[model samples]
Structures are given as C-alpha cells and as structure tokens.
Target chain A: METDLFEQTILPHLDAAYNLARWLAGNEHDARDIVQEAALRAFKFFGGFRGGDARAWLLAIVRNTAFTKMRAQPAQDLGPDDLDKIEDTAPQPAQVLERAGNIEAMRAAIAKLPVEFREVIVFREMENFSYKEIAELVNAPIGTVMSRLARARAQLREIILADANLRETRS
Target chain B: MNCEEVRELVHAYADGELDVARSVDFERHIANCESCAAALRNVRALKPAIRGSYYAAPDDLRASVLRFPSSPDGVRQSGGLPAAERRAGSWLLTGLAIAAALILGFFVGDAFLRRSANQNLLAEITDAHVRSLAANHLADVASSDQHTVRPWFEGKIDFAPPVEDLATAGFPLVGGRLEYLRGRPVAALVYQRRKHFVNLFIWPGDHVTEIRDEKPQRGYNIVHWANDGMTYFAVSEISAPELRQFARDFTTALSH
Candidate 1:
C-alpha cells in the first residue's frame, strides 16, 4: 500500500525532479546522483507529502538535495566578472530582439545567471510555475519571486543581446 | 497605469498572473501604448523560447526508479527473514546471502531487461508528451511556418532538427520545442491531426537507418523510429494507424 502511494505520488514526477536537479547541479552526472538521493529522501519522507502538488513537493526535495551537495563541494573559481559585466551593459530594446530567436545564445545567458535568478527563470518560464507556487517551493515570499523573475529575465535579455553584438563584430 | 506602473506589472501581465481588474487595466494601457504593447510581446515571445530549452531525464533513470523498493521500510524487509534474525546474522553470512541474491537476480532478471528498457523509453516520452499538453506548454515556438519554427532550434541543439509542414498530407505543422530524451537534448515537433496534437521528438542517432514500432500506453499511441542519423518519436491520442500515417508522411517529407 505504501509502495502504491509512493509510486502514485512521486514516481510520476521523475522528469521534473531530474530537470530541477540538472539545473541546480550544473551537469548530468551530478544531477543523476542528486536525483537518486532526492528520490530516496522523498521515499523516506513520503508520509509528510500532505496531499499537495507532488511535482512541487518532489522538486523542493531535489532542490534541497542539490543545495546540500553543492555546499559540500568547494565553489568554482569563476569569479564576479560575469556579474560585473551584466551591470556594465545598459539594456537596449533593439538588442534584446536582435538576440531573441537565437536559442543557443539565450541558453548560455540563462546558464550564466546567479542561482537565485536562474532557478526562478527555470521554474517560471520553463516550467510555467506560478509565482505563489514558486515562492512556496523556494521558501521565499511571493514578492521576492516576482522581483527575482523580473530581474532574471531582464538580465538574461541583456546578456543575450550583448553576446549578439560581440558575434556581429567578430564576423 | 502610467509607464512606471506598467513597467512594474509588465511581466505579471504577460504571464496572465494578474487579477481580472488589474488585467483589464493592464490591457487598456497596453492597447493605447505601442511601446508597452511591444514590450509585452517580447515578454511573451521570450518565455516560449526559454520553455523550448530544457533537459530531459535519462532513459534508464525511470526504470531504475521503478525497480527501487516501494517504501523506505521495504529495504528492511529483505530476504523474508525476521527483523531480529536478519540483524543478528553473522556479517559473513549476511554478505554471502546478499551475493547469492545478487547473482540470482542478475540471471533471472536478464530476460526481461530488454523489454523493460523499451518500456521505460516509451513511458518517458509518453509522459513528456502528456506533461507538455497538461501544462499547456506543448509548443515553445508556436508557428505553422516551418521556416520560423525550424530555425528557432539553431544553436539551441547541436544538430539541425528537420521541421516540415505536412498540412498538404492532412497533418499540419504546429510548432516545436527542445526536449531532452535518453539523457541528451532533442527537438520536439508539435503537429496536429484534426483536434489531436502530436509530439514528435527528434535527435541525432548513431547511424543512418529506418525502424518503426507503434506502442500504446494509457490511451496514447506512440510511433517511434530512427532514420538517416536522426531518431524520431511521435506521440498522440489519435488512433495508432493515423499516427503511423503521420509518421510516414513526416519521413517522406524529411527525405526530400
């Protein structure tokens, strides 16, 4: 009976769990391991699921698992140079549109965003998660989710446009 | 709403997250202001583009998960021995018992392994197709024009995904999105047959070949194949024969 419940509640969300883990862990191997660990944790704590959005609940566990894994490892040496670069560019509307259809450019831009901003974009734009749901999942208030999503999109646009300009000159 | 207020609410307005009254006000402002309207369109366009780019879980991930003991306590229920006896057994005996179980499982489970792998792939893609529809995110780049939708995948994936308009053959091109299948990025082409939506996931295959199979799961018909260094999986709620026809037409179009 408990096995049936676990299968019904958690197994269906395996893609979502893997997706969140991939984004947070920054690669496939770590993401896979993290997802396995997260699933085990979810199974152990299945009683606490509380009849809500299973995808969001499982994703929260995946997010927490990824965070714990990251904390245990030393941070990458890529410094604040990217953040500094983002502040340097004054966003222009024409630039954003110019880079709009370039999916590769956009993916790279989003990948470079800070984790806080990146997760909001992944949850909102990619996953179609609502603001309130995002707040609850990420343990932030609604207002913070809104602002972070806004900031993430704006920064992503600027970065894509900047990359477009760089390519144009090189060509 | 003034430009400042409109700017603040633009994202919310584009997301359709605003309340009705606020939405009405937002629309009123957008209708009157060209710049704000353009900004809203950009916001709308950017979202689908982002949704088009995502990672799919590995193929075996689901099967491995399915094989995991259902409940946490199931791990303790190993070998049908009483909890006390199992814990009190000598460590060497426990190790030998585990090794024996592992060897037995390997030989006995080997026969079903191939079928399970196929089932897991079918389940994964079907679930992806269903989730795309359920989430109302079936197409990140929603355009009937193959020119517009096909180029949308450029740089998003490592290969150029074949996108064709099969409207002439009774299957119309809907749009496409980037999906991960079996651990790598693939392109998902959304097509429509009557009122039914078809999700065709394509990625680069190892060799040039043609193989087709029609499998039904939970009322959805899935037809998948690999051809000319590209793999395709077409899934929909339409009849299996209709989906097969769609696949044939798609393959013919790609060959040109």
Candidate 2:
C-alpha cells in the first residue's frame, strides 16, 4: 500500500523536487542527492506524507535539508550589508534590444538578487506553480507569497534597471 | 476589481489558473481598463523571458528519473534496463534515428560519432547532467539553504557527503539536486565556483565501484574521482582546468 502511494503520488513530483533541490543546493548533483535521499526518506516515513500538497510536502523536505546543510557551514558574510540601494536603472531602449538578446544576463542579475527576493521570484517565475502552491511550498500564507513576489519582481526590476554590477562604459 | 487586486491576479491569470468566477470578473475588468490591460500584457511578456533564461535538462534526465525506481534495493532498483522493457526495437529505432541525424548534421563529421542504440551508462550520466543543468527543473529542492536540505538525507543513506559551507573556500553552497545513480539516491551538492556549478555526487564508496579522474564528457568538464572511498563528480561549464582546481579544493576540504 505504501509502495503504491510512493509510485503514485511521490514519483510524480520528482522533477519538482529536483528543481527545488538544485536551486537550494546551487548545482545539479547535490540537489539530485538531496531530493533522492529526501524522496527515499519521505517514503519510509510515509506517515508524514498525509498529504495536503505533495509538492509542498516535498519542498518542505527540501527546505529542511538545505537549512540543515546551511547550519553546519560557517556563517557567510552578508553581501553589501544594505541591499536597499540595489541598482534600478533600466537599459536604454536601443541598448536593451541589443544585450537583451541572451538569457545569461537575466540569469546573472537574478542570481545577484537577495535570497528573500530570489526564492519567491525563482519559484513563481521558473516553476510555473500557482500562488497557492508556492505559498504552501514555502510554508507561507498566500498573501505573503503574493507580496513577496511583488517585492521580488520590483527588486528584480530595480536590479535589471540599475545594472549596478555592470559598468556604464560597457553600455 | 481595483488595479492592485487586478495586478495580483494578473500573474495568476497569465498562468490560466484563475477559477471561472474570478477569471470572468478579472476579464471584465481588463476589458474596461487600459492600464490594467497594458499591465497584463507586460506581465505576460515576462513569462517567456523568465522561462528562456532557464536551461532545460536533456530528455535523458527524465528518462533516468522515470526509469528510476523510488523503492529501496530492499525493493526494486534503478540499475540497468528492465528485462521486460528491453526490446530490440527501441535500440534499433534509436540507432536509425541517430544515423538519420548524422546525415543532416554533416558538419558534425568525425567529431561527434553516431551514438549506438544501446545507451551507455556513462553517456547517460553525462546526458543526465546536461539535461538537469539545462532545465530549470533540475533540483527537486532549490535553495542556497543547506540547513533545510541536508537533513532530508538522514535515515536514507548510511554516509554523509561531507556537506559543509565552502563559502570561505570561494564556493558558497547553493543547494542540492537529487540524482538516481548506481541504483541508489546520491546527493549532488550544488556549489558555485564563479558561474559554473560543481555537482558533487556523493554516495558511500564501497569496494563495488572504482573511481577515475576528471574527464571531458560531452563537452562538460567532469571531475569523477573518489575521496574517503566516496564517489563525487564536480561538473561545470567552466574550463576543465578551473573545474579541476575547484575539485582539488573540494577534495582538500573534504579531507579535513
């Protein structure tokens, strides 16, 4: 019966789990290991799988795993101290058309965004999950997800527009 | 609905996830309002751009994942092809397809040989890596947050992969990606060495498997070696030299 549930419910969310793991782990392999192990464990302890949202249940596991690894490591120095002045300058209409060609710059910009902003944006933007799904995945309420997404997008706009990391000379 | 209420649902709308009532209500409001309509258009535009930024993993990852058995070795395993599913037509069809592709891609000459219908495990591993990296669908759990991720491994594996904060080592731990390798789930610790990713696939290194040096697999530099009898692969888009350097550093960190 448990194996049946594992195949039916848990198996479907493997990709979702892997993506969330990759994002949390920052690469492919670790996330794979994290999710695989999480899935295996999630199955053995099927008692916890008393499902509201399987994706959320999986994500919560991923979040918990990432948090565990984070605690074991030494604290990282916070970036720039203040992320408020994140550059918000938009590209010139002409230049925008030119450099906006590739997705690389956009990825780099998003990578530079703070975690709070990045998580919401990545989940909302990349995963294509509903607001309700994301809220449940992050263990936050729907309103918080909406607000964070708004802030995240606004912050992303600021970062892209600001182009703080890039030099004006390049433009 | 007001602009704020309308804007919130715009994302929801772009996804086509709104219910019949709310969907109709929002559409009616958009019909009346120009600013809201323009905002919807702009928001919708962002979707493709955001998606485009993501690199989808190749089909093999999905194949391996689907082929993967979630049950324990105490149950079914993901190693090798299922006897029932291993038909000659699949391989023959694959071979014929590869041969057909070879003719069109004439420029790809001697450099890229025709892949045999029989999928090589090594090739599949590399394909899985590329496919995983290409897709935003890579990690089952995405976070730079290691805390929330590592514990999910407990009770599932007997060995720890020496997962730690390597930020001081210049590779800030990003998150983890789950991989099905060698019939078991191995944790791939994701870390950033500049822009490239190191996929440290760790499993208990027993006498069963032999380790090898970093090799260039399908253009991606792969550092496949064992430390503490554990297997790890640090793969990245960066040059082989840089990846090797990062791998050596990771090895040293693991040693201590």
lDDT of 1 by residue, A1-171 (tens): 455556656765687788788878778888887877777668668888889777788898888888887773324442332212221222346766656655666777888888888788888866667999999988878877777777777678777877878888999
lDDT of 1 at A86: 22
Clash pairs, candidate 1, are none
lDDT of 1 by residue, B1-256 (tens): 8766777788787676899888888889978987777666766656645765676678798776655442233233223233553353443454455445545555555545555656867987998899888657787788999999988887667689888999999999889887656434578999988988999999887765454655688889888777777888889998888888988899898888
Q: Candidate 1, residue A168: CA error in Å?
A: 6.4
Best by lDDT: 1
DockQ by candidate, in order: 0.26, 0.07
How much lDDT does each candidate structure score?
0.73, 0.57
Q: Which whole-number lDDT from 0 to 100 does residue B99 have in model 1?
A: 44
lDDT of 2 by residue, B184-254 (tens): 34677777778666666777654433334444767777766665667666667777777667777777766
User: Deviation in angstroms for B253 in model 2?
Assistant: 57
Clash number for candidate 1: 0
TM-score, each model? 0.64, 0.44
